[model samples]
Target: MRGTALGAGVLFAGGLGGGWALYTKLSDNITADDAAAAELARYERERPTALVRGAQNILVIGSDTRAGDGNRRYGKDSGTERSDTTILLHLAADRRSATAVSLPRDLMVHVPGCLQSDGHRGEPSFTLFNSAFEVGGSACTVRTVEKLTDIRVDHYVVVDFSGFKDMIDAIDGVQVCLKKPIDDKAAKLRLPAGRVTLDGEQALGYVRARKSLGDGSDTGRMDRQQRFLGALVSKVQSSDVLLNPAKLYPLLDAATSALTTDPELASLRGLYQLVRGVRAIPTEHVQFLTVPREPYVYDSNRDQLVAGRADALFSLLRADRPVTVTKKNTSPGDSASPAFHGNTAAEDSCT
Candidate 1:
């Protein structure tokens, strides 16, 4: 999701006057996931149909692969990776609002059979949601998400750790207010309490640091990630960045270089069209929330959907209906209410 916003920033910079050569270079940076598209084409009949004509649902995946150049510091390259973070972004038909729903990697869900890298079809199984990525990469992850939520996915984007860090550096830094100090050696982060600005490396650790933070649960990490993203979006939309071409150029480069998307969004023009629709959406209209879930019945570490609540949230998104969310937590069994626990981009994290 952060990559999507940063990529859109490129269009604004390009329009200012980089000429054809620079535009070509930036556009070429985006990798087209033709393999995933081909795999998805095989299951077109099984995929859900798009309900709203102008609405869009994009799956933004943060890949935790340690094989890359700058990523070796995180861990050893095990020749495999999973979806470290996954968010389903829904843009309203009117383009007045957007909702980002985070899906926990530990959530237990039914994964549909998918074609594996070994050139064989793997049998369907019930397992951790992130397992889909480990088995078949983006194609399998998309199929699993589609199966989990009946909403159609129009496109998908994969971003990596190095790219994420580069984007933060490009934007200077994102400001965050911490109530307590943090010193997570595992995440390579050490920061004092209160308001502070985080560089690319620190921002990565801030969002990824689980054990040294509140509750030490993925849920807490997800909430912190949402808040940090909101802060990033707010910073990008500020006049200081948008009004300056020098600032926009680095952001443009970092964003395009970071993404791997489906064929439709693999080019500058396609991404431009997407940005044009969403660039004007007000900050207050941007909502962020996690899917309703509870600890898995069989295992305390795993998660399961909160029965009727999860289905209700999915239903609203499928129809492109408005989803209202509050900051306060709601009962897991409360399905009659329309509002869920969440926060908007307009809210100040420091407050």
Candidate 2:
């Protein structure tokens, strides 16, 4: 199945990054308030659990800050860059069929009015949605997404480059099949081809190096990232870590040290339960894709996501139904040519 091995890698990565044992890590780091973390965790536990729907949307952000020792090498004396990486995973309620959609950080979006630990404070603005994180934080980003897509984000997860490495290392190493050699000066990675295992450090470079890969577009990087993630998923499912206590401990410790999640997935137990659905899902049903896109309406240099296509895909997930992306040939009026015809969704795995 697609990503079956990668899923296993992701599971180990999750633990290496940290588990519920360290759910309090993020809560402890927040300067917000004493009662805030508990309140958030409580709300997450008590949040209205939903029935398995065909699809669901999750916003995954990869922060660029190299604030800690583990991350400094990636940043290398440079200031933190924008999240450059944004992915939206649409999972069928059944947890069988899935699709990963990537959003370019440069997409011009309508940032909406938001709320945070405090009460309402400002009006909406017109800028990229990712900039919302820099301006305010999660609340603003959530509100902006709500405003732009009218999609109520059920959950949110934010991980930095350091976390990605820790997660990779926790899984021991993920095996990847490379067709050719790669040398990226930016990420400081020069690797040969073959199915070699990747540690967190090497994995980080593998995902972040774009200049030496494909068309040198962020879109190309995203494609490779998806393949890596897919492999990570497969690894997690087929591996014995979840069933092996000895291997699980170090993985959990690493993951806990590197992560900071929203209140919903703030605790180790909470995050585990949510991902448990994916862990149990079948490999063939999972797929990854970038949102349908074209050159920006204004700037030829940037890419703009297709409006109705993404929104429609999200709708299918929200409904827990099946959707098949078809390809259009080079014939007349063949503007869209979807690369993959992802399979239809099936039974809810969570159930």
Candidate 3:
């Protein structure tokens, strides 16, 4: 399913240039003077780095933008950006299993205090979770997550809107089973649904499809993407892409071109390590999770996620503990939750 799912992206404060050497982008108005630059230099040096061990957590993002050549052809976009998708991919210490956690963008959160690109003092604001990226980029988002989950974010990766299309096209296409017709004006999709393996454009629309999909809720959309990701991962591992050099060549090119990651993880070797670790997850043990959520009781109009449950989930990841997906409904979760699929043999065997 990894194939159909891509993490959502976008955040401007201090982003890297997809290079091995970390390149920071400063605000046009805020100049980094000598002292400020020196301090940042020292900070970079002291920034703790971790080695690949047992369980791990990596934040993956998919940028919602139409600024690239392929994206611009699709439609005009607003100047601002938002995370089209967000997923926390976790691998156990032994690398025998894996899990991908999806965080609801609209879930109201206490955005931790941080410095913005404009040198403005940012206080803890009650805003949508995605706002962390908008106000302070990946750094602030990481800070906010640390504050909320207390889980150390090892590294981050980003994928652009156009690049995702390129990836789908590069892989030829992905199979999808659609039972109903789709004609979503918002997603710019029009297709009579069935069991169809979609191409680049159609697949993109399929994953981003909101209005014409299910209930048009972000939660529903996440479910669709997660399922697709599962299918994608299955395809990659099952197909002879690696064994057949010809098939693997296009795949590698697309992956490198479409991905942007922290400097230390921008190389082919780094990617190979990551994919190897993940592939070790026996086909049965891979899983997906959504932050437990409930309707916004305080606002009634939005969502107020179940904070304690989410905290517990992250704690499990931080400790590299095997996640016990609660399947027998004791909660008010919908059928969309993949975790509720019962604790079968596949639940406990992974790393």
Candidate 4:
């Protein structure tokens, strides 16, 4: 999930060796500079104290907003933002492992009052987790997440549709495999079953398409997205993007353009330091999973976290322990999400 930022940071660290003159391609760009500055300027009140030194937590948000030309073409410019996807990325102090936990957007929670555009706080209410984004942007969402997980979010990165597409193209493409053919007009995606390489547009379609791809459930869609991110991690690790500036510049541009980070991580040096810690971690140590959840007891349309399991998972992260996810074998009729199902970047689509 955070592989984009991690990869960019690790690559930039090496680029820095060539001197500041070489990085003018990134620092001089107005869009990236302004966006970085905006993230630096966001104000926050409550933040959790780190339990482990050198360990870092970042919230990666996939904003479903039609604010840019590249994104407007895909959806209506509703003038409001929502988080389509959110992942909590944890980097261990030893830098030997990374854990990414996906929070369901439909999960119901209490949204606290947030600072509004008018400079006053809005009223608090109970709503879906994603609603926090619409109510007060990223900070509200962070607050909601903090309330839910009891963990401090050290930083956050928000990326929109176009930014995601651009990043995919910058890296050439991510490889994926399908068990069956897909043709979803609503998602603007079409592909035959088998091994395939998807470019920017196609990759976006693949990740966003749910109706014709899986069981037509958000959980299924999230699983697919996680797999795609796993593939992306592999691509970055194996490719020469880090060693080649020609390839690195476009990635930096695409990543920075779409990113909204916290003040501390808004600069190139700060980003580099955050990413450097995870560069040496083996791909197998990077895991992706969701907090255990089920249909809300009161509303079938919404989701409720499975308390015991969810708490256990959060506790592990809080204590800086590696989460253990056992791969479960599912029968053909099983559609239930596994208790702990996740794949490492070392495992490709075919795996």
Q: What does the lDDT read for residue 134 in candidate 2?
A: 61
Q: Write the per-residue lDDT of candidate 3 for residues 128-243, one digit (tens) a residue.
A: 88887777666666656656666666667777777777666766776666677777777777777666677778878878776567987887788777767765676566545444
TM-score of each: 0.95, 0.75, 0.77, 0.88
Instruction: Give candidate 2 misplaced runs (Cα > 4 Å).
Output: 1-56, 76-81, 113-123, 325-351
How would you order the candidates by TM-score, starting with the best?
A: 1, 4, 3, 2
Ranking by lDDT: 1, 4, 3, 2
- What's the true lDDT of residue 54 in model 3? 53
lDDT by residue for model 4 over 1-351, one digit each (tens)?
A: 334444564456455676465454444332332332343245434546678888888888898998877788777888888999999998898989998899998999888888654567789888899988887777788888888988878777788898899888988888898877878887787888888889999998888776676888888888888888888887777647665666667777777666766666665666666776677778888888888889999999789998877887887788788777654463212123323666666766565
Candidate 2 colliding pairs, count:
43
**Candidate number with the higher TM-score (1 or 3):** 1
Report, for every candidate in turn, its global Cα lDDT versus the true structure: 0.86, 0.59, 0.61, 0.76
Among residues 3 or more apart in sequence or in different chains, the pairs in candidate 1 whose N, CA or C atoms overlap within 3 Å are none
Which stretches of candidate 1 lie above 4 Å from their native place? 1-18, 329-334
In Å, residue 222's CA in model 1 sits off its true spot by 0.3
Superposed Cα deviation of residue 162, candidate 4 (Å): 1.0
Candidate 4 residue spans exceeding 4 A from truth? 1-19, 28-46, 330-339
**Model 1, range 114-187, lDDT digits (tens) per residue?**
88888898999999999999999999999999999998999999999999999889879888888888877888
